[model samples]
Target: MQTSQQIVGQFRRKRLFIAAMVAVLVLVLTLSFRFFEEKSRIEQQSRDFANHTIARFDRMFSPLDVSANNTQALVGLRCGEVRFPLIENLASLQTVRAILLVDHGNIYCSSIYGERAISFSEAYPELAISSQRMLLTTDNYLLKGSPVLMLWTPKTLDNHSGLIQVINIELMSNYLLEPTLPWVERAVFNVGGKSLEYGNPLIEEALPSADEVSYEESSLRYPFSITLFGPPPARLALMTLPSQLPLALLLSMLTSYIVWLATANRMSMAWQISYGLTAKEFMVYCQPIINASSGNCDGIELLLRWHNARQGWIPPDVFIPLAERQNLIAPLTRFVITEMVAHLPVMPRCKSFHVAINVAASHFRDRAILDDLQTLWWPANPVPQLVVELTERDALPVVDQRVISHLHKVGVQLAIDDFGTGHSSLSYLKTLQPDVLKIDKMFTAAIGTDAINATVTDMVISLAQRLNISLVAEGVETEEQANYLRERGVDRLQGYFYARPMPLGDFPAWMDRHLAHIAA
Candidate 1:
């Protein structure tokens, strides 16, 4: 018996072989379908061309039948008297070689041989009968060694006199079919078992056998048919394979890439995060947190801004949670802190100036986060007070107790962000004993309109007062909200009414303009 590892290895090899075979089969089927589709398209185009050519021939020749009828009427009135003008009119037509007036099996007048009587039955025995209406013939009779079509109409003038118009075959071939002759290798036009061919002389002499020929036939309006022959299907497929194979492979690759991109899910986001970090696409924005009574700039909250190369300025609400889920929040948080430390010297010089950073709940579970902060903080003397704002989106794990203790020991302040939004707000408040409580924007937006939200805000204020904890009202947009929060003894305020978040580079200019406006 085989060992367990050997058996497992053998199974894996079999599975891999089967998967490879399946992939090859799929590729073969895809290429086969692509080849057949191209072949079908070519066949359809050929059919349309043949049909169009036949229709054009019909339209060109339909008028000749009507001309024959009119000439028959003229023949009935004095056949010998109307002969001169009749022959002149027929000779002027480009396709008409000659017109002859035949009466009782005898030609009395002709366009080429004028007023010369000849035996019509001996010269052309087939057209001797006055009953024969239309005939396409190749025999050399009146034109002498040229193919022509004879259009004869009979009338009862001096015992069955008839008008015969002889049409030149070469003229018809040149005008009607010459332009499109090169489209096919060989083409044969057949009318009443008589055939005229137009194509390459070499191809016509050595025509392919029936088994080796790919031919298409189209019927004309006047008892005629056009047969076109080209290279066999296998030969055509082989000739086109070189050009079409690469296109098929390229299309298959594109289809596979699109499917992979769509189904990659978290892997795609991982790639975006990796590329964004490597490219330094992330930036920091600072929103001013003001003292409610003093109206002085107390501190600023640091917010993450991602400027994707393709999609600009991804909102924190989208990317932050994604980072947390991917276990990449630690690296992202490290990037923010590192950027803040690097720009610390250029920041506005104020004794009480502080910068607060938002932290994911997952970061609390990792002790490495504290190590990273200590590495940056220990080097700078008189560093601005650092506040770590924790949100309630994810619960604080019990394992983070040691990390939280280490942070507090190092003079890092902790604040509960978006208060009253989470499920266990009161429990967290009692257990964590946080330094600041930031009222969520949802509650502040509902202060005037929503009764339940207003009461909740009032209750939060009363509780904060009793606990002696600092309270900050967020999203205070209007004077009414600002005044309401101020009256309730909210310690600090942050919102669009104060100032929207600006890049760190632009903050100093904004601060100067703001302070100047307030002073003025």
Candidate 2:
């Protein structure tokens, strides 16, 4: 049974780890895709601009050689002044920048409103030539638009009169791509094995021709320069990537936090199953607090618990705090004590022995608890002299004394459960002064290995002795701890090394088992 529990616990840990890893992995995958997608989108935008610009320009310059058998009116004002209304018509398209008709050169009868006509020298070398349905800039947006198609047309007039129209839309920076963040100093997307630089190095490196191209992320290192491939024939079209990586990093942080919260909630539920403690459910598992130094027959501690039957055992660590926050601690403690005392006489040796119990300080503050105890004591002749163990954590000094005084007045003994673990144990000692000090499990954890701990133990024992108090060592998991505590004059001890908590019905069987061990 123990092995099975250990296996289940291991599985839970592994599963949580895997889930956390998967969450991180999924985020990484998304980041990888985003990085490349940004690059592709930029490239696609460049191509779209090139294509759109070139298409409209194509119809304007090549208008079927002035029609066949046309009248003087149709060709009115001759070649340079031909009625190429179609050229001006395409300009209405929002995406179209402008249209220019270069008949017999010399910026001959142009209709380009937006694009201020510049000499061939001012525009890149052959950027003015429109040839064979293709557009070529003498110098690429050398910094921006990727060169789409470059072609040449033979001139029919002025020897150099062939139309040369270069197509170029807005730059990627001014158009499509949005920076991932304000702090992203650099973003270099390598998709299709072709590098794209935004807000950094200008010019995308074209890919080696491949049938199918897909980009796989190799590494994503930080804190580096994102300079575009520098120094072009014609400069001025380069800008750095928007410095905004905080947005992406913030997203990662949020993802991690969400995962942490979810896992914590799930584990809280799982622990409820294992321990059977929750807000609404009640459970009890009596365990013997054996004095191993003398014999395995000291007494039993009636551990009252809250279990959420549907959700499982709420871990005391989780639900107890919630109960306290909700102000349910007092009622919970009262209910446990009342129920346990009612069932006391039926347990193994309720008439003959002492049974210690834990009570939250919330109950200690309520005077009703004292009255109730008196009523419970009235019925049974001896009225079970319960060793009321008050947890140090919740035992406030102001009320602890009031409660302890009441318990003493009612003839019930008091024990300080988890003695040295509370933040105010030493301070509270002078005021609240509980009867028995149940040593915290942690002090005994390293008893055999440390001398200072032994000295500390001795000092605590001395303090208890001075106060005429008794010491009960808790969590004596090893014989060594029990021996050490016994040697140091600890009056009682409890641990799994002796026995785990059990149901009251199993008391007789446990005693019988101990007897058999004693005999052996």
Candidate 3:
């Protein structure tokens, strides 16, 4: 069978393992969710950038298309008659740098330099066909090195006559095709078989393939489309994942701590008890023991109180029985003794005034209780007497009479507490020959209401008087109960009616008030 200590150790290890597993689970789930979310965000950004660039392309060229269509009638007219009209049209359009007239496969007029004798098919074979509407090329006649978008409108369907509008696409490409990195590394404007990317002075010979494009958007009103290229959405999302690690770790730790706190009750309370002892979380409180006949406070019982750091104010019933069961009562009793010795100044400097503490039967083994008192208590040379109350809940071990005699010789008194609550009360009276018999609270509560128990209370008082032992009535709550016990010759009364248990440091003030009230 596992001992309590072994069980406590195993429980602690298991709780820590569970908390670590929860932390790892939380971290993995958070990072996975963030990765997918970032990927979706990057994908959306790419798509929006491509579509917005397409809309700008249409806006830049739609006016040029309208102006070119209006000038198509001047295609067959002489350059002398149509030159001024073309220049006026060009001046009205902000983007159009030049306009040309093409008739019967010959380029004969220009808005910037009129009366041109250039052959349409040799000079520009792509536009001479009159079938293609747009081309991204650097072959602008006036701006030699700059890229331009050529808008074509044919006068007739004979593959001969048309108007050509050269737009300054290179200048507009700065804002129109700008790439927003790291999602979009490059943005390209494609027309026919040519391509122009941001900040490029000349058109590219070939466009990017399908694999290199991240997102592509085409203009519904024009032939051109904007293509965005960069790392894949998943890769870009991964690159940004490092930035989120600190927050993910923090949240995981917080989640783990919360789980640990939630499961604290299930963890070993024995370990908590041991920890409380070491941390000095236990405190000493004293209930005033009033001399019933004189109504004078003559003694106080030192009670153990625990204030756990995590769980505040643990009741004595919860820990006392457990402490005895786990064999920890001996250490706890020693703690109470040490604390009493430290706070001895609070008690009156009179040997007749006693301070009492309950001690478990197991502490008597090998004279452990005696050694604790000698080591921690005797050195202080306290003015008040020390009383050890042995509850009848446990059978008193067979102790040497010399130990009891020696305790009596040194001013320590033995008392039987909670007298009738246990099975061995009468046997305890014969064996221990205690100096004091404390009538348990149940019998005191039966003072008026219970006839049989009240008879039993009277019998106990009669027994104590015949044995020449002083009697202390426990839980004397009402004045009638106090009067009944006092009239029955009970020597001392301990209950809330006199004074509730308070910190030992407050006892001096409480003693002064009680003495003053009695004197008044």
Candidate 4:
């Protein structure tokens, strides 16, 4: 069987393992929440940027669309009368470079140069077909190779007569399509099927990779959209992970430590006593009860002593009372009975020799003590007589007389140990009619020193003698005390004066030596 210390060590290791697992679980959960939170923040940021840029593009094109529609009404009129109004319209809108009027499949008037005759269908064939259209195209004829945004508002449904407005789109691209670093590395502005990026020429295919794009937004009022592209939101969230690690580790460690501290009391001394029982660390000891007059050992009181593998030599004063409080004393008592039965060979095999074991008050409930004796002790059928000792500290309940009678019928003697120390002395005498009354060591030690206790001691001896009860004076340390007890007709004397409590295995050799000393 494993010792108590080994079991305790296993418990501590298990606790630490659980604590560490909890710490690791806490750390992982915290980081997961943080990563999702950061990803959400970056996604929102990208979305806002895309929307704001699309709004700027809508604002830029709205005024030009109104200007071209107004000028379309003057398309078939006299050029001399309406040409100056076209120049005034172009000057009013700062983004508009120029405006032109097309009349019956020909450009009839211009705001910048005067009158011209450019074919509407041949020069810009795509615009001639649509009634209202926005296009991103390069002005190769006038400002060669420079990108411009063109709006066509036709005067009639014939696809020939209309007004064309031109915007210097390259200058506007710098402000509306500027990239936001770290979040948005580049922004693209797409019109019709053509796309333009800030500080770069327009491209035929301006599609951003799905993995690299942060957010994309299309204008509701125009044929255009803005796309912001950079590293994925997931990657940005991960970049922030290093900064979040230290606090997460600290919190997880604090939680684990609190858990460890909270469980300390559960694994305290009471738990150790229980473990000690399982590990069989408790040893059975016996203090010899000498015959006061003959100086011959008549009986032995079985005592319990603990020697923990880790914490050695625990005192009875500490663990005994604790065991009773923790409801473990009964099991401990059962262990003592079992050990005594196993080591019965080491004891004197005579009916006159008694083996006394202390029983706690709780053990009397439901005739538990009687049951233990009958089940564990009576089966052994050892030669020595059995004595059940009740101490003054015990407060036994109203026991059924049948149980006591059964114990007496089985040749079990009842003794009241540590007599005259409690208020129940007279009550026990009236109820139990005990065979032996062991005087408390306090009164025995006070034999010659204190008169008041000495008188009480005398009374106890006299009372037992009158009742024909056997008297056992404990704590007899000197010849004076022994002589006094023997002179007073005390039936037995037990204390340091004879022999101290020793292990059950050593009793046989000690008895031989004691008998030899008595004979000498």
Off by over 4 Å in 2: 1-280, 305-310, 348-352, 375-383, 395-400
Candidate 1 displacement at residue 66 in angstroms: 68
- The candidate scoring highest on TM-score is 4
Which segments of model 1 are wrong by more than 4 Å?
1-231, 234-267, 349-351
- In the range 274-314, model 3's lDDT, one tens digit per residue, is 89998989998989999987888889998999897766677
What lDDT tens digits, residue by residue, belong to model 2 across residues 395-492?
46475477677677767777877777677778767776677888888778858677777677778888898888978888889888878788777888
Model 4 — TM-score against the truth?
A: 0.57
lDDT of each: 0.71, 0.53, 0.85, 0.84
Error of 4 at 9 (Å): 20
Residue 181 C-alpha lDDT in model 4: 77
Worst 10 residues of 3 by lDDT: 1-10
TM-scores of the models, in the order given: 0.55, 0.45, 0.55, 0.57
lDDT of 1 by residue, 221-261 (tens): 46566666665544555566777667756665665555444
Error of 4 at 376 (Å): 1.5
Error of 3 at 103 (Å): 23
Predicted structure 3, TM vs. truth: 0.55
